[model samples]
Target: MKFRKVTETDVAKIVEMIADDELGKTRENYQIPLPTEYLIAFENIQADPNQELIILENENFEIIGTLQLSFIQYLTYRGRIRAQIEAVRIRKDKRGFGIGKKMFEWAINRAIERNAHLLQLTTDKKRQKAIKFYEDLGFKATYEGMKMHF
Candidate 1:
């Protein structure tokens, strides 16, 4: 498999991945939803300098997985750069092949290339497998993040 930045042509595959109803518990609450406006927003975000959206491609150049890492520069940490990782998904049939791990490594490397000092991600507490996977990759659970959804 090869890794590359996302393009407009890969949106359908990404939507498929995002809309999967089953795989892990985190997906259970997500309802696997992604609206068209979200796609437009992602397109705009991808064009910005602070975001990195990457996909893994097979021999036929079909996207098999995707991950997005966004850099956050904060004044609280003395201007240290941070990266928030999101949308990490691999095709259901493509699991156990190390694709997710590779995608994650690519994102971490991208974060370093962009001068990020820390990387963070959030998963549902019920997703034990996913949480273990992230922990195996050296990610720790430290903070409780609250969200206000509209």
Candidate 2:
């Protein structure tokens, strides 16, 4: 497996991977013509120095996973930088192969390399399996996450 920054060409595959899941099927629109919003968001992310949109590929060069990491510099924690992990998705057929664990390990190492003092992520409450997976990977459920959708 190889990890690399996602390119503009990878957006379609990323959208397909996200839409493969139950929740994503409801939330993402992967219809014909595709959505301009996704590309727009991708470009925005690409332009941000603090944001990293990554893709994991197999030996055959097929994209099997993806995630985004954002490094924030804040006054909290003595002004230390914090890394936020988001939009993590592994191909449905690729689960249970210990790939997700490897992905987190890579993310953690990447955070350390960037001098981030803390690494964090928010997962939907409905994803019990994912919650367990994260806990097993040494993430603590220390706070409640709240969001207001527009």
Candidate 3:
């Protein structure tokens, strides 16, 4: 297994993985959604110096998991930077096999490479296992995340 930046060729596999996750449910609410295009946009964001997204692939070069790392700069913290981790997904069949742990480690390393002070992510309350996984990885349940779906 290896971790790398996404390429255009990885769009199809990336879409498959995303469409099978909770994100797909969000997309379903859209009148017309093109997952392939979304993947392309992710690549674009990663290419930008201000953004980053890392993908996990197996020996066959299939994108089995993904995570987004956004570098944030804050004034209150004296210009300290942090990496906000998001959209961490592992293929349903590939869950419970240490894939999440490995992917998270990569994200942490990526944050360190970029000189980020902290790594953070949020999960829905219903995803109990996911919350536990993050805690096991040393992520604390710091603040409650609230969102208003429009």
Q: Among these predicted structures, which one has the highest TM-score?
A: 2
Write candidate 2's Cα lDDT for 1-150 as tens digits: 999999989999999998999899999999656699999999999999999999999999999999999999999899999999999999989999999999999999999999999899999999999999999999999999999999
* Candidate 3 local lDDT, 40-73, one digit each (tens): 5866786788677678888997778987788988
User: lDDT of each model, Cα atoms only?
Assistant: 0.81, 0.95, 0.79
lDDT of 1 by residue, 6-94 (tens): 87767767767876635534443232244466578667978798887888998988788988888888996789999999889998888
Candidate 2 segments exceeding 4 Å error:
none
Q: lDDT of candidate 1?
A: 0.81
Clashing pairs in 2: none
Q: Give model 3 RMSD, 1 decimal.
A: 2.8
Q: Judged by TM-score relative to the true structure, which candidate is superior, 2 or 3?
A: 2
Candidate 2 RMSD to the correct structure: 0.8
Candidate 1 structure, TM-score to reference: 0.87
